[model samples]
Structure formats: structure tokens, C-alpha cells
Target chain A: MTLKIKKTDYIVITAILVWGLVGFWFNVQGAGAAEHKYATIYVQNEQVAELSLSEADSYEYSFDFGPENEHTALVEVEEGRIRMLPLEDDICPRHICSHTGWIEYTYEKIVCLPNQIMVVFNESSRGTTREDLDGVTY
Target chain B: MQPTTLKMRNRLNYLTYLAVLITFAVVIHTVEAALPLPMPVPGVRLGLANVITILALVLFGLRSGLLIAVVRSILGSLFIGGLFGFGFWLSITAGVTSCLVMGLVLVFQKRGLVSLVSVSVIGAAAHNLTQLGMASLIIANPDLLRGYYPLLLLLSIPTGLFTGITAHYLEDVTRRMIIKSGPGAGQ
Candidate 1:
């Protein structure tokens, strides 16, 4: 078994480890100290809606989605954090978006792949540039 | 043993073995999809079905491994009722890509340059990267790849290690079983 641990194998393993570490470090740093002030919703890569987040403003919003708009996603915001309400229609088979529970940080994003919907948090002072959270590399 | 007769028998044996491996892989894939992980990560899974793929590759060859990967992904998606959906596309693309990667690694393994564990690790990493890349394309969001890639890469190491070890032992057990079955068993 030890014989199988050849020089090339070690290089592959070490490269993977280093790449993963760098990505993780970048993710942590990109998510650093910035406060999220707005939650922007994008459908098919277009900004469909934007909601300013604040401790004093809490509300639930429902929007139509899907090819024929046959499905709806209900979003709940409380104390500046956002979450998706589980729908009976099951627009998404996996329900990963709803199961994501809540997003309080700029790094967290609620994405519904089936519906092509994405909800991302933006920093208070940063422009609506999506690349701010795209710094994590692998 | 007559050469032609032995060749035919070996073909029969491989066909039956392929069927069995596909069945095992399908069951594992469907069950894994049904069982949700505690973490909310979008695309992370143990990829346990890969064990059978590696097993087939080790026992049979690249062709067998690729056949199992494609057949199992399709049948498994059918079982889970996700056929032709986003998840199905993601799985098929990733599965085929990784199987090919493992097949390439098999050459080195034969030369004693790498072990089954390395083959599995490379396959797992390829699977994850391919899945992430496909997801990004389908979702039209590069951030999805950028954001969660590290976590997926990190997780693949352990998951790959577990599946690789399992595949190694499974290959041993399966070979032993074949040897014990009879002299007529395909070598």
C-alpha cells in the first residue's frame, strides 16, 4: 500500500489540499465584516426585485415563477435575514431553497435551481455588483 | 478449457456481473437522493454509488465502468422521478465525466503508479468539479461555482477516501468470491 503512494500521487493529493484551502480562505475573507443591507432577487440572471433589509422592516413576499408562472415562491424576511417558505406545490423537487432555512450573511445565497431563481444579499455600501461574493475560487 | 468456449463463458460472466453492478449502483443512487443530508449544501453527497463503478472498473474494465455509470444514473433518476430534470442532467454529465477520469487513472494503476484510492479521489474530484460547472451553466450563475466550490472540494477528499477504501475491499471480496465459486469462474 505504501508503495502505491508514489511521487505523482502525493503531488495530486497535495494540489487538491492546497487548492481547497485557498478556496476556503478566499470564501471566508470575501464574506468578512461587511453588513448585508439588501436582498436582491434574480430570475434567469435578471434583477426581478430588490428588498432593503432592516431590523425594523419584516415582511413576507410571494412571487410567481416557472415557465408558465404556475408556481410561486414565498419569501419571509425577519430582522434583516431572509428565508423561503416551503410551498405545497413543491416547485423544486429537492426543496433545497426552502430547506436552506435562512440567510443572514452576504455570503449566503438561496438558489432555486428548478425555477432559475436566486436570492443574494448585498453589502450596505457596495454596489449591486454580484462579483463581490464571487471571489471564492477552487 | 477450450479457448473459444472460455471466451464465451467469460463474456457471459461479465454480462451477469455488469447487470448486478448496475442494480447495486441504481439502488444506492436512488436511496442517496431520497435521504437528505443535514447540511444545506446544494450539491454535496457521499457519492456512495461510485463504489460500484470503481468495482466494475477494477473487475472488468473502463467500458464496463462507463456502462454502469450511464445506466445507473438514468435508471436511478427514473426511480427518483427526476428523469430529464436539472438534477438528472447534472448527475449524468458528472457521472460520465468522472468515469472517464477514473478510466484514465486505471492505466497508471495497471503500471503501479497509483492505487485504487487515487483513482477514486481523482474521480470524486472530477465529479464534483463537473457537477459544479454544469450547475453554473444551467443556472447561469458563475457565483454558484465560485461560492461553494471550496466546500465541495474539501468535502470530496474525505468522501472520496471513504468510497475508495470501500471499493478496494469490495474488489478483494468479489475476486475472492469468484475464485472460490469454481475453477470455471472467469478469471
Candidate 2:
């Protein structure tokens, strides 16, 4: 028996290809640049603090979700990049956030789902808050 | 032979075929899971078990295909101890969504509007989309759909084609086997 390819098959494949390409283009465009100048911290989807990446600093922040649920994360900014160290006092089962080492790109982020904390980088001059990074971080 | 007896035997044969297909799907799933992923992206897989599901769909019917998909996913998850968790929910949702989409495609194929490869591609894409949607909801992060969704769609093409070819061959071989073995060979 001979396998036959139909016009509809080509159409569907082309559609998927175009969609994926457009998505990839938008993703790349949204990334802006690879330069990192500031590190912003968000707790519970709200921006809590912003740190200058030019200066070396290490700090610990605690997020209290409720009376019994509290999580702490160690944020370290050094050499124009930022990293979240594994928190010894975090309640999350896996320390995946801490293991995601130094992020310097504008679109890069370190997210702690259990704590609802997100540390993301941006260009210092782009005072405009872009929601492009919202759903991109895993 | 009695008509009732022959009908009973046919039903039994189909049930046995379903059992064998389910076992084959579970084994494929387990072995695929054991293989190291080429990428670190979550929810991306070769979906090797889909080969069995598609073959069942083609050889038997929509009901048998759906039965294989549902049973294999649940039992496979149980075997892996992933039942009721994030992975289990994602797999079940994807499996059902793809099964329905593939069934619809099969309907269109009967009219000569689509082909098996197209069905597999659409099914694979549907699986990814369903999983992404479920994952985002479970993680309470709609952001999970941003960059990964497109990548998953693209990856599904190759994987779908591979499974489609495998199913095509398996379907032919199984059909020949069934013919040679006659109606109630196992009995």
C-alpha cells in the first residue's frame, strides 16, 4: 500500500511552522539585550526591592506566606550578575531555585514558586516595566 | 458454531488485544522515561507510547484507541508512582486531549481530507498544548506558556512523524498476524 500525502497535511504543517517561528521571533525580540544592570525582587507577584548589579552585595529575604509557611532566600549580586543561593531555611521540597546559578541577561530570572518570589534582571536605563518576562521563567 | 458463541469469542479476542496493547504502551512509556532527555525542558518527551495508541486506533477503532490511551496513562503513572501528582494530571489531560483530536482527524481522514501523519502531528501538538495549559494552572504561573510552548510545538513534529511511521508499520504487521491467526486464534 502506498502512503498518500494530502494538501491539508501540508497546510497544517505549514501553519504550525509559521506559528512556532513567529513565537520564537517574539521571544528573541522580547529578550532585548544580554546586559544586566539591575536585579529586582518580587514577592507574591509584587515588586519588593531593586538592587544595583554594579555593586557587590549579599542579602537574605524572608517571605511569609502565612503563619506556618515562611521561606527564606539568599540573594547575591556580584561581578555584574546576580544569583540566588540555596536557602537552608526554605520549606520547598526541592531547592531548584537556588540551583539555578547566576543570571545576567535581561530576560533571565530565578523564581521560587513555593515562596512566590522572583528575581529578574533588567537594563538600568529601561525604566519601563516590561511584563515580557512574566510567563517566560520556569 | 453458535452465533452467540462466535460473538463472545470476538469480544474476548478484542479484550485480549487491548490488554496486550496496554502492556506494550506501558513498557514503551517506562523505557522512554528511563532514557536521558536531550534537553532540560520540562514536559518534553519522545512520546514513544503514542505509537501503540495510534496503532490501536487504526486497527480497532476510536473506542479502542481511547481505551488504550486512558488505561495506559493511568497504569503507567501508577507504576511510576506519579499518580495524582502534577505529572499524573498533566499526562492524563494530554492523553485524553490528543486521543479526541486524533479521533476527529480520523473522521476527516475517512472523507479523504487528512492523512495518518497529519493526525499524528495534530495529536502531538494538542498533547503539548494541553500539558502546557495544565502545567501553568497547576503551578499558578501563566508564564510557563511563554517560551516553552512554541518550542514544544516544533519538537512535536519530528516526534509525531516518528511515531506515525512506527504505527503504520505495526498496523500492517498486526493486520497480517490477525489474518493468519484467523478469528479466534488465541482461544
Candidate 3:
């Protein structure tokens, strides 16, 4: 039997490919354009902590996270790189944040959905939070 | 044989097909979960089990296809130890939503407006976007939408095409097989 590939099928496929490539182009252009110098931690959409990632900077801090601030999260930064350690009472099943290791680029981020934690890298030292890189095509 | 007996036999035959489809879906789901994806973004997958979904929907009906999709997600998550977890919820929501979208597309497909590949592509995109939206809602992080959704959208195109092509060909093979072996063969 012959496979029936109609005109609409070609149109749909082409539309999806073009849309996808456009989104990809925007993402590529937005990322890695600035020199990331800080790692900002956000929990439940609230900015909790910001740490510098300068070569001479080194720090390890345990910050309270979660809805009630009951869970403790540790972060370590050394030599212009930063990483998030697992929680003391790690309720997160995946621990994807810790598995992500270190992120030094402006485009890289560590997100732990289970614990509602996000570590985002930014270029500016403080203020001017770069609006989380736009292009929200779904 | 009594008429009721023949009816019962037919019902059993139909149930068996659905059962086999569900089993195939579960196996593919679990195996795909275990395989490593080259993409760094989380929640991006090949969605290979969609082939079984398309097969069931095209051959059996929408209800059976939806049944397979939900059951496969539930059982597959159970096997992978992600039951009721964030990923589990993501899988369930995305799976059901995509199944419904494909079922809707199947209506147009019957009218010759689109092909199986088009149906599959639309369903795959629905699944990916739904998962991202659900994840964003669960975490209360709208930043994820602006940060990661675009990249995932870009990646879904190729992966959707891959599963769509596979489902298209498999649908053909299975149709021929059913015609040869099914009870309606003489008719």
C-alpha cells in the first residue's frame, strides 16, 4: 500500500521545523554573551542568596530553603565556579542540582524542581538581574 | 456455538489486543527512561512509546489509545521508582494531554486532511510543552519558561519527526497484519 502523505502534512512539518530553528537561534544568541561573575540562588521565586565567582573568592555557606525554611542547602564556590551540594535532609529524589556539578557560564543553571531551588549564573555583580533570558515560545 | 459465546470471544479478542498494546507501551517507556539522552536539558526524551500510542489509536480507537498512554506512564514510572514524584506527575500529565491531542488530530486524519506523521508531530510537541508548563507550575518558577522552554521546543522537532516516521510505518505494517489475520478477513 502507498503511504499517504498529504499537502497539510508537509506544511505542518515545515512550520514546526522553522519555528524550532527560530527559537534555537534566539537562545544561542542570548546565551554566553556576557561574562558571568555571580551565582544567584532562587527558591520559590524569591532571591535568597548571591555569591561572587571571582578567581580569588572562595566560600561555603548553608542557607535555609523550602517553604517553611526548614531544609538546609549548601553551596560552594571556588575559583570562578560554583556548585550546589545536596541538602542535609535531602527530600529531593533526583538531586539533579548536585548532579549538575559546577556551572561557570552565564547560560548554565542548576534547577532542582523537587525542592523548588534554582541557581542561576549572571554577568553583573549585583542589581541588573538580566531578566532570565527571554524567548518563551512553547 | 451460541451467539453469546461468539460475542464473548470477540470481546476477549479485542481485550487481548489492548492488553498486548499496553504491555508493549510499558516496555518501551521503561527502556527509553533507562537510556541516556545526549541533551543536557532535563525532561527531553525521544518519546518512542508514542509509536504504540499511535498504533492503538489508529487501529482500536481513542479510548483504547488513552488507556494505554495512562497505564504505560503509571506502570513505567513504578518500574523506574519515580512513582508520585515530580517526574511521574510530569509523565502522566504530558502523556494524557498528548494522547488527547493526537486523538483529535486522528479525526482530521480520517478525513484525509493530514498524515500519521503530522498527527504524531503535533502530539509530541504537546507532550513536551505540557511537561514544561507543568514543571513550571509545580515549582512556582516562571523563570523556567523564559530560561529553558525555548530550547526544549527547538529539540522537540527532530525527536518528534523520528517517532512520527516510526509510527507511520508501523501503522502500515500492523494494518496489513490485522487485515490478514482478523475475523473480518473473509469479508
Candidate 4:
């Protein structure tokens, strides 16, 4: 029997190829972070603080969801990048966020589900006119 | 042969076929789950279980294919203690969506609009999209789709093609065996 290629086959193949290409492009764009200069922290989807990555600094933030549901993360800014340092004190089950080191890309995020906290990098601090803000501001 | 006895035998055959297909699917699912992947992507898998689903759809009909998909997913989740969690919901939704898409393609196949491989690819894509939609809703992050869904779609193609080829061969062999056994063997 001869194997026949139908119109639907071509459509399916083209769709998959296009999807893969688009996904790959986004991933590449997200990983390019040389131009990013700020890291913003959010607690429960609310913006808590924004820190500049133009200089080196370190700080700690805590989220208290309830009496026994508090969580803390050590945020460090160095080498034009921001990262959450993995600490033994973290009570989260999987320390994946802490293990994700040095996120410099604008789209990169460090999320702590248990504490409902997210740290994301941005090109500039939100609602700010200047790109050179050096200190953390709420 | 008596008509009533033949009818009863045919019913028995169908029930037996369904049970066997479900068992095969569950076994394949569990085994594939145990295999290690290069990455820890949540929805990524070889999808060997779809082999049975496609076989049932091609050899029997839409209802049998849907029944096998539903039963296999539910039973697999129950066996793995994922009956009431995010994983269970994703699996059931993906399974049902893929089966329905494949069934639709099969309807079109009657008019030679698509081949088995195309049907499998569409089903696989549908499965990934359904899972991505469910995951986005659960996490309340539409960004998840933007970030990860494309990779899942790209992976589905090769996996779908492999399962489709396997199902095609298995269906042919089983069909021939049934015909050779007796006129009533496949009834």
C-alpha cells in the first residue's frame, strides 16, 4: 500500500512547527537580561518593594500569611543581578525558588508558593521615571 | 449456532476487549510514569498509553475509544492515589479532549480528509492545550501558557506520531487475528 499525505497532515505539522518556533523565540527573549536593571518583590500579588540591581545589596523579606504560615527569603543583588539565597531557615517544602540563582532577565521570576511571594526582574522599577534608582522603595 | 447464544458471545467479546484495552493503557501509563525524563516538565511524557486509545478508536468505534480513555484515566489515577488532585484533573481533561478530537478526526477519515497520523497529532495537540488551559486556571497565571505551552506542543508531535504508528500496526495485527480465529471472534 502506498502511504498518502493529506492536507490535514500538512496543517498539523505546520501548526506544531510554528508553535515550537514561537515558544523558542520567547524563551530566548526572556533569557536575554543584560538590559534589565531592577528587581521587584510582590506579596500576595501586591507590590511590596522594588530594588535596583545597578549596585550590590542584600536584604531579607518576610511574608506572614498566618501564625504558622510565615516565610522569609534572603534577597541579594550583586553583579548586576538579583537572586534569592537558599537558607536553612526556609520552611518551604521544595526550595526550588532559592535554588534558582541570580535572575538578571526582565522576565525571570522567583516564586514562593507557600508564602505567596514573588520576586521578578524588570527593566526599571514600576511607575518610576528614572532608571537609576539605587535603593529599595515601597 | 443459536442467535441468542451468538449475541451473548458478541457482548462478552466486546466487554473482554474493553477490559483488556483498559488494562494495557493503565499499565503503559504507570510504566511510562516511572521512566525518567531529561527534564522535569510537568506535562511531558512519552504518552505510550495513547497507543491503546487509538487502537480502540480505529478498531472498534468512537464510544469504545471514549470509554477506554475515561476508564483508563480514572483507574490510573486511583491506582496512583491521584484521584482528587491537580494531576487527576489534568489527566482526565486531557484524555477526554484528545479522545474527542481523535473521534472527530476519525469521522473525517471516512471521507479521506485525514490519515491516522494526522488524527493522532491533532489529538496530542488537543491534550496539551487542555492541560495548559487547566494549569493556567489552577495557578491563576495566564503567563504559564505563554512560557511553557509551546514546548509542550512541540514535544507532542513526535510522541503522537510514534503512538499512532504503533497503534496502526497493532490494530492491523489484531484485526487479522480476529478474522483468522473465526467469523464471530471480533463480534
**Which model scores highest in TM-score?**
2
Chain A: TM-score in each model: 0.61, 0.53, 0.61, 0.52
Off by over 4 Å in 4: A1-7, A26-138, B1-3, B182-187
Candidate 2 displacement at residue A109 in angstroms: 15
Candidate 1 wrong stretches, greater than 4 Å: A1-10, A29-138, B1-4, B182-187
Query: Lowest summed lDDT over 10 consecutive residues: which window, candidate 3 chain B?
Result: B1-10
Write the residue-wise lDDT of candidate 4 on A28-59 in tens digits.
67655434367778877888788876544545
What lDDT tens digits, residue by residue, belong to model 4 across residues B37-73? 8976766887889989998998889899988888888
Q: Give the alpha carbon lDDT tens digit for every residue of A73-92 in model 2.
A: 56777766678777654465
Using TM-score, rank the candidates from best to worst: 2, 4, 1, 3
> For model 2 chain B, where is the 10-residue window of minimal lDDT?
B178-187
Cα distance off (Å), candidate 1, residue A37 = 13
Docking class of 2: acceptable
Q: Give the lDDT of residue A47 in candidate 2.
A: 80
Candidate 3 global TM-score: 0.65
Instruction: Name the runs in model 3 displaced over 4 angstroms.
Output: A24-138, B1-4, B184-187
Superior by lDDT: candidate 2 or candidate 4 = 2
**Model 4 chain A worst lDDT run, 10 consecutive residues:** A123-132
Task: Report per-candidate DockQ.
Answer: 0.23, 0.39, 0.26, 0.30
Write down the TM-score of every candidate. Answer: 0.65, 0.67, 0.65, 0.65
User: Across residues A3-56, which tens digit of lDDT does each residue of candidate 1 receive?
Assistant: 245677667777788899999888777765433478989888888788877666
Query: Which stretches in model 2 have alpha-carbon errors above 4 Å?
Result: A33-138, B1-4, B184-187
* Best model per DockQ: 2
Candidate 4, CAPRI quality class derived from DockQ: acceptable
Ranking, lDDT, top scorer first: 1, 3, 2, 4
